[model samples]
Target: MNPSASQNIRPETVAKVRTGIPGFDSISEGGLPRARATLIAGTAGSAKTVFAVHYLAAGITQADEPGVFVTFEDSVADVRKNMLGFGWDIARWEKEGKWAFVDAAPDAEGPIAIVGDYDLGGLLARIEHAVKKIGAKRVSLDSLNALFVQFKDHAMLRAELFRITSTLKRMGVTVVFTGERIDEYGDVTRHGIEEFVADNVVILRNSLEEERRRRTVEILKMRGTTHQRGEFPFTLSSREGIIVIPLSQIQLTQSSSTVRITSGVKELDRMCGGGFFRDSVILASGASGTGKTLLVTQFMSGGFKAKERSLLFAFEESKDQLFRNAAAWGMDFAGMEQKERLMVVNRYPHAMAMEDHLVEMQQIIDDFKPNRVAVDSLSALERVSSLRGFREFVISLTSTLKQKETAGLFTSTSPSLLGGTSVTEKHISTLTDSIILLRYVESFGTMRRALVVLKMRGSQHDDAIREYTIDGKGMHIGDRLSAITGVLSGHTTFEGE
Candidate 1:
């Protein structure tokens, strides 16, 4: 007798089981394959057990699906206590009959001796009973290597793995098996055969980059579905569990805004072809004391004045200091914040990783839903990440803001004090929709401020460098400084000299 056509259909067409972890489903191209075994491998302290617990917790809470967690390393009570720290009341879930645990950890008193030929039949039986008891749709066998370490024969270990995985698949329960990677860069599992037996494999890495610990996740293999194929940054937080930052998957679809938004300084707005597009990214680049932060403040203040919500990420200043500086220029930043029109987030650059900063910004943008955002200074962030990483982050951040139709203004500090040039100008200039240069011109034996629009991708802008003044009333753009040549180069000379 032949099987039905549906039986021969590819597994990819089957519906996926959503993991309910933030950003996990999106990066997995939905979620884990249904009714299949997935191997979660990592080194010590890599949060492998924590990841498994989260998977089960999410299934029980969000998917209305009962789950069974079979731990071979930690006791059921210990697992419960650890999960409680993460705000997951696994004990309560057990009482509600939504989840169950199989404690197969070796007794602390002594090791069990198995003299006869053995298989995982007893463990499989316990799992089957738990599934039948709670009607579980999800299962996790954490630290699968704990059971393998007991057997000396590699063939027996592989056979037991195949049996357990095949039995779980026949039960029609989506399963996750946590294993420890033996070498720093070797097989996904210590035994080297689990990865081959599992339907999917996800490797979690916690490595030091520049003496800072970085956590990343990569899908090594997936049998039926196409998953994102790069190592993406992830964070394990007490409140949100495993949150992945899928920066590599960001789409670059250009989202345009026909409406032009003011830059607060009326003359500067006029110079940018009547202000900036609503969803554009503007780079305000200059050296130290060139008023880059002030330009960002004015742009944010303009959004506040227009009744549009604004967010300011201050890397170098506190909220109070930013408010004081804005107040010096006649802008009431505190009042705007009090009115809920503005929000200022201050974070020291050294306090967190670049990926952490990206996650923070993503959360704030989601919660605040601001119409405008300003990052007062990318140079601080560059100090924390690699050049390539920084560029990727800028691209991801700007692309996300553009997709949300949020106008973003970012400040970059030129290394030279006399406006020699900026590395950021060469690197990030293409990612932005417009480039606004703030510089100091050395003309007539004195230093004077100048402003110019170097590039605006989709709009015409004034090419002439205009002199500007910063005072109690904020930036004031005067007539174009057509008399000075090399204004951008700091060594300016009279045009007719």
Candidate 2:
């Protein structure tokens, strides 16, 4: 493939209903078919309603396609209020006769609303009334589950599902029908009748795994179209609405070739291959007082010198305190801030949610377009909240860095609670693109720190754990200390002469 073609956005050649959600249409390989029905199934809290509302709103705003929202669960006013996150004034559209809402809650009750009593005819008439009144081209049924009360039998509901979906398709109105799906156990809230009815099935799932709740989406099937089939992570915010940071788009790009960070100490950069690679993630882990701070600060300073913007989110120290400490080491801190190349974000553990911190960091990244980002000490992040929340925060933070092609350097305090190579927080290690272990070893009644490059994706790094130090002149690295052992265990032994 040509290198430049990787970032290209070739517009799709199809009559489609564009769901204006960011990173959404691109993943669908374009957009939903113009006059077809797409099923959105997921357990509650999977954002099935939010997804349905956003699709309708996006069509009204982006495609200029008038829309009708048929609600079986909530009232029209309730649905509109729920969608306030999209920054949409739905009432204005309704007033303009370009959109309409129909409540099916009453029809979904004791009386059978299947064929003639309160059936497809009445529903179709209401939809047509709304469409012709305002020239609407898109529709969203809040749920297909409500029909179960009206159509008691599986075979009967299945027929009604087909009838409703087919009627909308034949009317040339793009439709999104919301439903629910069973989990990995196939134990759904109900049968899969609704899933089998729609032409395209997209499942959204959110679950608690290992103390963390994550959201993922997959396309079960999309008839007559080739769609990428995988459950990718996504976030829905009040500001950006719904966004899925496609990992598929994160291939190493040539544009990131020239970015670099300064080793906190000059000699340290020479020990490692050239400074850290652009857009790469580097993990700096060590026990207390191993010069990890000096190394990371040097990297931050390097970014400042190059006039590349950077963010320093420190949990271990205040901005003034870090500056004072750096000054003691003879590192230039005041000079860099004068040049406007660096910005520090200091926060305490109890202030907010890990998710909130990620959101705030994302805003700063988007505003500054920084090339370097540093989160000093992953251990500090752990101190704030639940393990799962921290993992989600890390995932969101790292994923944002890769998307923006920013070189991220994170420090972690290790030598674990049990004092061995085993890490209680394995999620941090798994998410990092590279791992640099720092250990303080006791040798002959003296304390010394060692540095080792454990892992680096897409780039080779030296594997030796060399002796390193920090004094008034800043950090320094010496040749590999072959005489020492037990460095990883936090205890050291040397060969006797």
Candidate 3:
């Protein structure tokens, strides 16, 4: 209870062990406290096992430090098979004396039975033996809730876990203990016994929001250390294990350039003070059929014509549709691909979670090293996630694009065909460096299209709502709608009506 006692328990200069989990070490400051036990608690199907396996696998593969995995819930074979998807070859690791398993599952070989106020001396001894045999610097005891379930006395279970953790720490082995939670938002653990033994506590949550499931990890507390607060979104990848998206930890030190890149449309470029910034995110928002895609096509072509690499992620159209549409607009998407000047990736919005989509797309951006990137119709992805999730996705995406120091153009479809604000605009307006609005205007008895440079950060832009026309060639920016008012609100009035 005293500050001096707390300081004595965990010294001010406590060292940390990098967990090797992607993006986790950033949020955890420098990773888990060395030679201390960390509690990973989560509800059913929260990938708790995967997290534990990943922690050890990272140490084994990246640091070449051996690890001991002690399982209490899942069998050793299941753990091995389930982890192969993440490219962790547990069997091979075991053969090379790099990994050891202390299988303590019920009815398994050397199961520890709980009769009355049972001591974990036998299990601890087995764990110590495994650690000694493999020379494991990292150890994981998965799902301690299994032991808690059998032990009715909570106080006794807590005492035993503390003792076990203490013994492991004394061995100078950094440890991880996975526990179970009944509810995603309930106590840290099912039995709430690990709070005393764990030097750090991390919670994994898979919560359902608006018919979509979102997974996030939060480091509740880390003794004698600072960590990023709040839950950070993470996704399970087949190649990599659990990847924590350290959104807050991303540095916004992207270098700004005075140079500008073409917006593909000469008039639009002139309107935008000689084109968009070299490292900026632009949003093209409009109702469907407002030529947002056409604008995007022109933007890409402008870059490709200059021999700059371009990447496009089409969410609302297929490869054929996009290529065909480009052909219709007199753009050669297929030829660009063949020439290796442009890369077009078409993905259905419902294919994966927003987090996965962001991570995968970011990876492609990094790999392709494009000079500019575009996402056609982000509104299509909006229906698949909650507003908050979509906002996070946009923030992360814009930050990534900026960090890449490449120009990014994103399209969003408004729900109203005539005129209206979109959900996407509400969430991503401030995040984007520029906003281009396309609207349909009804003058007299005919429908015409209009364009507006709504907001352009760090540059002077045309504030006039200009009427535009689209034909087989492409969008042609015409004169400003001098006689129209309130074009953005979808309700246009004659100047002197």
Best-matching candidate per lDDT: 3
Per-residue lDDT over 254-350 for candidate 1, one digit per residue giving the tens place of the 0 to 100 score: 4377789998778888888889888889899999988998898898899988999999999988888899999999899989999999999999888
Candidate 3: stretches off by over 4 Å: 1-12, 108-118, 150-156, 251-255
Q: What is candidate 3's lDDT per residue for 192-294, written digit by digit as tens?
A: 7666889889999999988889999999988877779999999998878888888887755433777899999999998898999999889999998999889
TM-score of each: 0.93, 0.79, 0.93
Instruction: Write the residue-wise lDDT of candidate 2 on 161-239 in tens digits.
Output: 6787687778788889887666733533356754566777777878765545667677777777656778766667777
Question: Local error of candidate 1 at 373, Å?
Answer: 1.1
lDDT for each candidate structure: 0.84, 0.72, 0.88
TM-score (C-alpha) between model 3 and the true structure: 0.93
- Decoy 2 TM-score against native: 0.79
